[model samples]
Target: MASPKLTWNIALAGECMAARPFSVHDDEESMRVINLLRGADLTYAHLEMNLAHSRELEYPNRGDWLGSFMMADPAVARDLKWAGIDIMSVAHNHSLDFGPAGMLATKKHLQEAGVEAAGTGLDLEEAREPAYLETRHGRVALISTTSGNKPNEWASLGKGGYKGRPGINPLRASFNYVLTKEAAEQMKAIARELDVLRQADGSTMGTGLKDNEFSFQMPGDQSTRGSNVFTAGDHFEIQSRCHPRDLAGNLRSIDEAKKMADLVIVAHHYNIADGKRREKVPTFVREFAHAAIDAGADIYVAHGWHWTLGIEIYKGKPIIYGTGNFFAQSEFIRRVPYDSYESWGHDMDRLPTLNPADHPLHPGLDTHNEAWWTSALMGLEMKDGQFVSMTLHPVEMGRTAREGTITRQTGQGDHALTDGRPLLATGETAERALGRIQRLSKNFGTEVTIENGVGVIRF
Candidate 1:
């Protein structure tokens, strides 16, 4: 007798916000979707929001600028468990919405649900640690990090009499804005009026700078190496790079994961688009994804902009730029902080019980936005430590009617709220959605063919 061929099936999705719990009564389409996930040897997705029972805002936090809170019901993790999610990456922008305690509670809930998560912990080292999921085929290792998180939300080291903070793993990056001469002058005046310039004593810059093109550099010991805020140019260009520590830390984790697991997946959350095209992958993301593959990642997935992006194949590996949403239940969330509403210039007293479309804070919840409702589940087949092919399963998110009934829809939906559960797309819907994916991925030099109802990538 010979050993098995060690063929493995893996499924991947992005940014699941399963605020509502599922039941046995779920529709057949939903069951089909779940079955596809359950069939995989290892299933992975980005757990977009925190999972907790309570809806209160506690702890000394500082992300009021986000203007919204994303907390899914912890019981929803049961739905993910039922859907057969093996591993998840939970280090995105909303990881600390309810503070570090909320993040920790989410980790506890996921653990209880038997879903291992990466990219968050009690300290920086732990946050950067790799999470493993053991399977009969092979052990799958996951390392997740986010490039867009609040400064205060970053996990810190407690050394030399400093106190360590609990938070998510971060792939931090900074933005430098360029502007016209007139706008630059205006920014300078505003900065001067606001006293943003650092004095001889070396103070901090203004946090409330309205102008993105204002150039302000904080003093350094031997060099002025702080982020230069802005420059005046006719046509502005922005430069972005993964932070050195974050890049090195995650790469180290990938190396370690290679030693421990048969397969490694790196999930990063970042949004870098080409102009108005939200699906365009940025240069930094491309660089980082390729580096991860070189460092030992079998698959590299990026998400967080809430739209499906392109895919690139580098060194016989797949780099999924963005998988859109596995589930987006933000519209169905019951409670949000009062400050969240206020940040959107809404009167707290006149709180409108309107739908997310009517609400300023959650315009994406509007079902009319087809991109928000369309996404795909990727299935990758690997055998004998070699790449095989990928299958794209186009899924249509469930939408809620004005009468509060759930309806399966593809493309645009009625003004009704989105239920945010994924279902397999069929008929012309599958063709259309998968066609869109083909178009999105073509620019990255990855081609796909629609076979039956799913998109196939033959190596």
Candidate 2:
């Protein structure tokens, strides 16, 4: 059932990596943020951490990736709901930290907390499907997928006699190394040195390098599997391309969702940065986002950069590039697996136990950086199935006042729950944050005007 005319408000938050439960406290600053969330007709957040019932089920260190294990108490789901988040996108790099058991437990918790979660399920079909949230104003459809899944983490359909993989819906991507002609020749010479280029037939493969598909791709030919090396003029850069199958699959879900709901929101979680820069949105993300909008997505939101990026207006709709991190308490997880300590080169057997603050990854891998601590909440309004206005309310989550540290020095035996929560930004902090957002959005020809303390995007 579709409404002839749609009018409502939606509040969008980037990622919630909360490692503990939260609630609407008595603090005036924090309550301002919560009140803003509750003011919207529909509220959304990306649930970037798993919900484990206990240490035994949620913290066995399940994920095999290089990323950290992010798991919060199952009760944290209720906190998100109480904080006014109606739906969450749970398809990010940290979603499988506790494996299927943890992921399933999280699903059950979200359901019990009365929160709708999309982008993960028992199989690819279910994962790629849209999850709808019913409201008095309208029915909103959410289709969430991620481009940052591990190689074996995709939810796969059962084939022949095998059972399906329980995981997140994947929107896969491959990188291409754009090299100069001289560099391309040098790679060919190295291939001659390594001897992994040629086949048993004695025919020379493209560039004659191991994983030659990664080493070279014929000019104008469609990019193939793996990372490809392309000689494009006299420059060196990394380019990304979305997997056609995965892109089409997600687009189909958007098309289906639009017909079923008054408004369709698509959330894409990607870790692919603009080269080594985490703040820049990748070209492939833009391409896929545009395709999604064309396929009937009313709004496109991206997260996983852990920093604010930019926003764009496409076809009279808003495409929020990245909103950075919210509820970013990664350093406050109660218990971590041995692998986390091992990643820091700590020998747990040879030494005493260590918490994240003391585990040598303190202040976090990116927390010390200013961008990682500052972000904005996107407030959007729509009427008659068209965009009305979009605003960015600046927010910050770090404490820079304590001896110039990213956060106040952590004391032993405390989770530091009160310190990492985000609140409404004001004064100089608000200006600096909104300034970065304005400059970034300018790259995409989107202008944001500072109205009071809020960043307003003029459509």
Candidate 3:
């Protein structure tokens, strides 16, 4: 069944970020991005930063090895709402940076600021449930999940006489590291030499679960570590897959969403990249996106790559694989906690004061990556829940060649607190960004027409 609403619009943006108040900036580029976002019946954005409700609420950095603490001021939530972000997916990797309290605080602030948040809660049940938004055109239901979470970050059910862990909705993925025969043999020889191949019980274990968690890499996805030699294949490759339970859980939520609301949208944050092949999409991500469409989701968005991927039209629905940063302001995060700094081997004494540009956590600021700098703000028009047409409004995040000239908006007197605004891509800037998306979409045989300096898709 399709949404009864006819000829309604939905704007899809990836990665919502803004530390300072963005509403203060009404520059041409800002207005261009804002107009499209506000004009949609449903506006979706992936929330990657925790609202620093209070730096004192901060827990010890949980993502030290793989990430850093990223926060925008709490008031930024209101700014985002005013700037037209109706719903946010709070199931990204950074959702737990400050712990459960921080995650809930972010959700509370979003709701208080008039925004709907999905994929995070005090229990696994709530986290997996759909969040709804009612509009004049139709009612929208969002089911958000993230594959980029750690063991401690997943919401778990409480046992007998206990409470469940408050966390983000998790869609755990597995990775199988394929090793060649020669490499496997070498590892086996080393394991035999070290006398660690067999347990005291004399049973050979193929893997362990600590360091390599391709399947959580949980200890033993890769057999190279610690005197453990496993079987090897003829060729080397990396295969990515998602857990069955998590997949079933999300698909059930999608079915629930379809029944609950007129439009069903599935937003998944899957940042796991294929090690052996960085360019191609992960096996499980594709499978999950298609499965979501099959389960009655009107739109399936898989993001958090920090780079744009391909787009696929599956069963007449849109499966947007990658949406680059909607707001590229990680570099503008006010404070880089001592934990994050120390993890990168930079203590307060070694590096007294940190400039955002000098920080290494945000590579997009220092690099010239096409997907990082330029992205599209996608607008889709649907009739009775059937896709009619789509428009890609090229967005130019600052500090890149793809962005337009900035009018220079700042937060207070602090340069670090400035708004991370996206300018409208013009001329060759728009052409190149759309061209990259076109080339990527071509991988799925989806042709994008470049008309009037924007990408258009009619189905």
TM-score of 3: 0.87
Off by over 4 Å in 2: 55-66, 198-225, 228-233, 355-357, 362-367, 400-418
The most accurate candidate by lDDT is 2
Clashing pairs for predicted structure model 1, backbone only = none
Clashes of each: 0, 1, 13
Q: The CA-based lDDT of model 3 is what? A: 0.77
Scored against the true structure, residue 270 in model 3 reaches a CA lDDT of: 81
lDDT per model vs. reference: 0.76, 0.78, 0.77
Residues 110-160 of candidate 2: C-alpha lDDT, one tens digit per residue? 989999999888889988899999998888899999986776579999999
lDDT of 1 by residue, 1-459 (tens): 533456788899777977778756467856888888899889998988788777434652543554447777788887788888989998988788788888898888999999999989999988999998888877889999887676778998899987788988888775566677787777778767766542233335334334334455433322343455676777667656677777888899999998888888999987444334455677677778988999989899999778777777888888898888878777666666666676666766776753334366654653455556677899998776556899999887763222223474323534445567888766655666687779988997889998888899877
How do these models rank on TM-score, best leading?
2, 3, 1
Among these predicted structures, which one has the highest TM-score?
2
Measured with C-alpha atoms, the lDDT of residue 354 in candidate 2 is 65
Compute the lDDT of residue 199 as modeled in candidate 1. 28
lDDT of 1 at 102: 88
Q: Please give the distance, in angstroms, between residue 196's alpha carbon in candidate 1 and its true position after superposition.
A: 6.2
Model 2 scores a TM of: 0.89
